[model samples]
Target: MPTELPMFPLGTVLFPGEALPLQVFEPRYLTMVDHCLAQPDRLRFGVVLIARGHEVGGGDDRTGVGTIARITSCRPGGGARLLIGSVGEQRIRVDEWLPDDPYPRAVVTEWPDEPSDVSDAAAGELTDRLAEFADLFARFSVRQGRPALPVPVWADLPGTDGDRGFALARSLPIGAIDRLRVLSAPGPGDRVLVLCDALADVVAALRFRLADPGGAE
Candidate 1:
């Protein structure tokens, strides 16, 4: 069934199973939050990247597609600060947008699922690479004393047999358009390839940062 949902367009696109933190202070968004809390289903909203348009108001080309996100925790700010932790659930295709309230509202339908087909060899390679990336991320977090971020709870995330490999590929440090392409990929294998491409850039960026004087180890 098609449903009306409140949309939160961001500078970045979030993937399912990824965590996104936001500072919500706008009055419309505050109302949206209140609505979600009061709803019986505790329905979540979509987090989408604002593509080729204005961010604060309406944009010229905003993708009707987005990932569903759940509000896990929220910290109220004295005046306009609202700290929120959200996790992406699934993909949705927006049918039509209604208006731009404090936040945007839209009528949407659930996007069709795109499962992946990964070969054993490719899967294995993905596993090793993800493990390396995960380790580096963990180390960097520890070295920098940054708050620990949550990884997926599912098994086989960075391994040969699990969907985790695909997840990690989509979630790594990548640009919004690349992330959107992964999200829009027709199948899992293609998505994984997109992830691999992003992984390459991630490696290059990490190396550059690490080599820099201001970059952490």
Candidate 2:
């Protein structure tokens, strides 16, 4: 069934079952926050990827395929300082959207969740590589006086590993199109594979950065 949802077009993409922390300072998004909190379902907002143009006046052109997200936690950072944690649910296709309001509203078509097609061997290898990568990341963060990156529970939950991979794949400081490509992948194997490639890229980038803080020719 189609639903009319309030839209939060972000500069990034979100993956299902993954948590995203956001600071809501924009007036329109603050309105979105109020609406979501007041709604009965609590499933009031959809997180859309910013595709083109700026967030201020971009309209619907800024958003891509989105996932229904719920406001899991909300805290007041001060006067109008809103901190929100959202967990991605399912994908949705935007049918119609209207901009120029306090917040954008989109008539969306829900995309149901599809089961994973990843083989055990593939999942295992992916998990192993991801674990090594995550451990390295956490160690680096702690060594740099930053909070430690959480150890991803990659074994007990197969689906979660895929979700984590996809989430990190989108979040890395890579090309925008590559992030979109991961989001648009066809199926579970394809998505996981894409994530693996992204992880590899991140590892390579980290090595390069550590080797040379400046882009030395």
lDDT of all the models against the reference?
A: 0.72, 0.70
Clashes of each: 3, 0
- Residue 151, model 2: lDDT of 51
State the lDDT at 25 in candidate 2: 80
Clashing pairs in 2: none
Give the residue spans of candidate 1 off by over 4 A. Answer: 124-166, 204-217
For model 1, where is the 10-residue window of minimal lDDT?
Answer: 153-162
Number of residue pairs clashing in candidate 2, backbone atoms closer than 3 angstroms, sequence gap of 3 or more or interchain:
0
What C-alpha lDDT, on a 0 to 100 scale, does residue 77 get in candidate 1?
A: 68
Candidate 1 local lDDT, residue 65: 72
The C-alpha TM-scores of every prediction are: 0.73, 0.72
lDDT by residue for model 2 (1-217), tens: 8778898887777767768888888888888899889866864588787876666644436655777887889899888779998888777778888664867888898864366677787677678767767766765665566886565544554445446556555444556666766666656667777766766777776666546645223
lDDT tens per residue, model 1, 35-72: 88786586599877888875554554688678899989
